[model samples]
Target chain A: MKRIALLGMPNTGKSTFFNRLTGASARIGNWPGITVDLLSARILLGADMVEVVDLPGFYDLHGFSEDEQVVRQFLQNNPIDLLCLIINATQIDQQLPLALQLRRLGLPTVAILNMADEAEQMGIRFDAAVLTAGLDSPVCFVSAKYGHGFSEARETLRQVLERNPPTNAAIQHTEFAADEALLAEAEKLVARSVSMPRVLEHGLTERIDRIVLHPILGIPLFFLALFFLFQAVYTLGGPLQDGMTWLLTTVHDQVLAHLQPILPGWLYGLLVEGVYDGLGTVASFVPIIVLFFLGMALIEDSGYLSRIAFLMDALMAKLGLDGRGFVMLMMGFGCNVPALLGTRVMRSRSLRLLTMLIIPFSLCSARLQVFVFLTTALFSSTQAPVVLFALYVVSFLTAFGTALLFKNRLPSREPLLIELPPYRLPTFKQVILRGWHEVHHFLSRASRFIIMGVVAIWLLTHLPPGVAVGGPQSLAGIFGSWLEPLLRPIGIDQQMAVVLLFGFVAKEIVLGAMAVIYGLEGDALSHLMAQRMDWVQAFSFMLFILIYTPCLSTVATLRSESKSLVFTGVSIVWSLGLAWVISFAFYQSARLLGY
Target chain B: MSMVRLSELAIGQQGIIGDMDAEGQFRQRLQSLGFRIGKEVRLIRQALFGGPLQVRVGSVNVMLRRCDAASIQIWAER
Candidate 1:
C-alpha cells in the first residue's frame, strides 16, 4: 500500500487531521511532542487503502532533538509516497519554513492550512492559489477541528498518489540549512499568500491564560484542578465500577453453572474461577481508568497541562528534573506504562531515565482503587478521603525524594524549554475520542498481564492434587507462610503476605485475592480485615502497599523503556526496600506513641 | 545606548532580539521556535521562584529557562 505521512510543527492540529483522514484516535493534545512515537494506520481515500503515518512534530528538519531524530529516522527508513505538511494557518510565517524544507526533499507534498476556522475568526485570510503557486504544490485550507476542507485535501492526496511520485532520492544528500535567506524566502511566500487584520486581536485563550497562569493563583488553581480530578474519579467512578462488577459477576456465575456439568472438574475450575474471576476483576476497573483518562484528556486538550510544567519548573529543577518530568510523573497517577512512554517528551536521555525511575512511586489508579477500598472499609466516610489524600501526598513525596536522591547518581543535563500553547476548550468529540483511545490502549495492554496473574494465583491456590484452595497445604499458602517471617516486622501476616505477593502482578487484583483468601466478599471482607488487624497495622499495611514493587506491566514497561535489565532490577529492589523500612518505621513509631 | 538580556526584560516589555549567545543544537532550537535575531518578542511573565520565563514570539508562546533567556540580548523599547 502507498504510504502518506502527515508532518508538521507541534500544536498545529496534525494529529486531529490524521485522525480525520484515517479514523485513528491518536492523542490530540495542545502541546508539542505529544506524538512522540510514529502512529500509522490504514486509511481509505476514495478507492485506495493507503497507509497514513503521523510523524512527531518538529520545528526544523535539521534540529537535533529526540523528536526530530525520530521523524528523520522514520522518513529515511520508509519510502513515503506523499507528505501532507500541515501548518497552523495563523502562524504561517513560522510554520511555512518547515514546509519549504520538506518540499525541498522532492516528496509529492500537499500543504494543509489547518485550524482555518480559528484563523478566519482572527480575521486572517490566506490565498490558497497564491500559496500553491509559490510552493509549487497543492495547498488546501482545512479546519481539522471542525472537519472542513478534508474531502478536497483527500482527493488531492489521492490524485498525487495515483501519479505514483518517485521517492525522494535527494533526501539522503539534502542538507537542511535554516539560514536567514531561506527563512526570508519562506517569509516572503507567506507574506504574499496571507493577510491579517491591522490590529492583532487576542482571543479567549489569552484572556483565560491571564488568570490561569497568574503567578499567585496558578499554583493553587493547579492543585484545585487535581483535587477536582480525584474527586471525580472517586465520586463518579465508584458507583459505575460497582455496577460493572455486579453485571460481570452475574455473567461469570451463569457461565460457570453451564460449564460445570459439560466440562471436567479441573477445566471448569480454570475457566470460571481462574479466567473469568481473574479477568473480570481487572476488567471492572476499566470505568475508573476511562474516567481518569477523560479528566486528563480535558486537562491536556485545554493546554493547562503544559502550564503545569511552567508552574512547577523551578520546584522540579531542585530535584534535577524539568517541569515536563513532573507532568509525566503526574501522568503516572493514571498508569505507569503511558507515563513511562510519555517520558519521550523530555529531550535528554538521562532526564527520561530519571523520570522513569520516579514514576513507579506515583500512586497509579490500581493502587488508588486499593487505597480507596481499604480506607473506606477501615475508616469512617469522613476519614477515608483524608487517608486517600495522604496516600497521594506520600506518593508525590516519595517520587520527589527519589529523584533528589538519584539526581547525582544519574546523568541529568536537559534544560527546560517547553511551549505553552494557548488554552482552547476541548471539543466534545476530541475529549471522548481521546478517552476512548486511552481506555482501549489500557485494556489491550494490561488485560494480558492481569489475566495471567489471576490464573496463576488460582492455580497456586487450587493445585497440589487434593489440597484445599488457599489452605496451608496449597502452593500459595505455603509460599505465603515462607514470606511471613520477612513481613512480620511490618505487621503483615501470612494472609496479607499472600495478597501482597499476588499484588505484584497487578494492584487491582489484591482485593479479589483478599476476598478469596478470607472466604468473604465485599463488606464482610472489610469487617473481617478490621477484626484481624488494628488501625495502626492496617495503615502500615496500606503504606507498604503504596511503596512496594510496581505491578508486572509497569516493570515490563520500565525494562523496555530503559532498555536495561540492571535498571529495572534496581527499581524493584529500591521500591521493595523503601516500602519495608517505611512500613516498619510507621508501625514502630505508632506503637511507641501509644496510639 | 543600552541593551538588556531577554531574561531581564520586565513583564509586558517588548524587544527586538539583537543576538543569541548559544550555538549549535540549542541555538537551532531557539531559532526554529521564532527566537531568531531581529524578531520581535515580549516577556509574558516570569515563573515563581526564579523558574523559566514565559515569552511570546510572533504567535507562539514558549517557556525558556532563565539561563537560556539571559544569553539572548534584546533591544528593549523604553
Candidate 2:
C-alpha cells in the first residue's frame, strides 16, 4: 500500500476527510520529532493498498512551530508518493505558501481546497481548473462537511498513482528559494476560474465581539459563560450520576452476595473491595466526563474557543504565554495527561513549558468526582458545586498569580491571528463520536491505573485479624505519619495522609485507596470523612488535592517535554509544599475566624 | 512622525505600521504573523485587564503584547 500523507492545518476538516476516506481504522499517534498529533489510515486504492497520514496543521511552512516542524520533518524523512495538501478555502492566504512549497517540491501534489461551501458563502472564489493548470497538478475543491468533491479527489488519486511515477529530487531543494511567480500564476488562475455567489453581508461576529471583547465587560462575560457551562454540567449530570452510581453499587452488591457462600474470605474481599470498588470509583466520573465533553464540544464547534483564547491573549502574553495556552489549561480540566499533550498547539518551548507547569492547577474532571462524592455525602449539592467551583477559581488564580510573579522573557505572542469560523449547532454524530472517544480513552487509562493501584493498595493494607499494626502501620503509613505534623495544621489525619502519599502515584488512586481503607461498605469512609471531619478538614483535603504533586505520568511527561528533570522536580516540590502551606493556612485561618 | 503606537489607535481605525522594536525578542514573532512594519493594519479589539491588543492585518487577526504594542509604530488615519 502506498503511503499518502494528508497534510493541512488543524480544524481544516482533516479528521473529517480522513473519516470520509477510511472509516474507523485510522490510527492516531504522536508525530515523530514533535508532540503534535498525527492520524494515518490505510485505504485500498484501485490496484494497490495505500496509507493516508494526517499531518498536523501549520499556518506557514517557514514558521518554526512544533506542528509546522512535524509536517516539515515528516515530508523530509518519509517522503510520500503523492502529497495531498488540504486547504480551507476560507483562509487560503495563510495556508497558500505551504501549498506552493509542496508544488515546488515537484511532488505529484493535489490541492484539495476543502470548505468550498464556506468559502462560497464568504464571497471567495477559487478557479480550481486555473489553479490546477497553473500549478501543473490537480486541484479538487471539496467540502468534507457536504461530502463534496470526494469522488473527484479519489479519481485524481487513482490517476496520480497510475503513472507509477518515481520520487522527484528537484522538489526537495525548493525550500531555499520559493517559486513566488508560480504562486502568482496560481492566484491568477483562481481569479479566472472560481465564481462565488454574492456573500450575505452580515457582522454577527463583529457585534458579538463588541460585547465579548469589551474592555469593561469582556472578562466578566467570559467568566459568565464559563459559569453557565459549569452550572449546566452539574445541573444536568447530577441525576445521571445518581442513577449510574446506583446501578454500579447494586451490581457490586449482587455480585458480592452471589459469591459470598462460594468463595474464601480473602478472595471475596479482593473482588468486592479491591477490584469492584476501585473500578467503581473511576466509573463514577463517567457523568462528569460526558457533561464536560458536551460543554467543550459545544464551545469548540461553535468556534467560541478561539475567541476565548483571543479574550485572554493579553493576560497570557503578560505571563509569557499565548491565548492558546488557555485551551491547553481547559483541556487539562479533562485530564492533565492529554492536556499536557494538547500543549502541542503552543509553538514556543518556554510557552509550552509554562502552560504545562500550570495545567495541573486546573480542577480536572477526575478530581470533580472526589469533590462531589465527599461533599455531597457531607454537604448539600448546592454547597458542593459552589465549593468545587471556588476551588477551581482559587487554583486558577494561584496559577495566574504565580505566572505573573515569575514573569520572564518567554515566547512572544503569535499575533492572535485566528480564523473565527461561524458558530453552528454541533452535529450529534460528531459530538457523540468525539465524546465517546475521549470517555473511552479516559476509562481505559483509568482501568489500567486502577487495577495496578488496587492490587498494590490491597497488599499495603492487608493484615491478619486484629493486626491493624502490620497493615495500616506499614511503610506507607510510617512515611505519611512522618509528615503528619506538617499536614496537621491542614487537618489531614494520618489515614488521609497515607492515601495522599499513595496519590502521588496517580490522583485517582487516592479515591481508590480511600475506598479500600474504609473497606468499601456502602461508601462508609467517604461518609465518615465528611461527617466526622470538620469543614476545615474537608476544605483542607480539597486544597491539598488541588495543588499536590502531580501523578507519575504527568511528571514523566513534563520531563520529556521540558527536557528538564530539574523543572519536573521543582514543580513537584513546589506543589507539595504549596499544597501543604495553602491548606494549612485555609484551615488554620478559618478555625481562628471561628468557622 | 513615526507611526503611532497600535495601543493608541482607535477601534475601526486603519493605519500603515512602521518599525516595531520587538521587545523581549518578540519582533520577529509578530512579524511572522503579518504584523511587520509597512503592513496595513486595523485595530480590531482590546481585551480587558489592559492586556494584549488585538488587530487585523490583511484578513488575519494578530495579537500583540501591550509591551510589543508600544514598539509598533503606525501611521494612524488622519
| Model-by-model DockQ, in order | 0.35, 0.22
Q: Choose the strongest candidate by lDDT.
A: 1
* Local accuracy of candidate 1 as per-residue lDDT tens digits, A400-487: 9999999888877665667887666677888899999988877775666566666677778887979987888998889989999899
Docking class of 1: acceptable
Lowest summed lDDT window (length 10), candidate 2 chain A: A195-204
Query: lDDT by residue for model 2 over A560-582, one digit each (tens)?
Result: 87788887887788778778888
Pairs of residues clashing in candidate 2: A1-A49, A9-A57, A105-A171, A127-A194, A314-B52, A415-B63, A416-B63, A417-B61, B3-B74
Off by over 4 Å in 2: A1-202, A317-322, A345-348, A408-425, A464-480, A521-525, B1-8, B16-40, B66-76
Two-chain complex of model 1, DockQ on C-alpha atoms against the true structure: 0.35
Q: Fraction of reference contacts reproduced per prediction? A: 0.64, 0.41
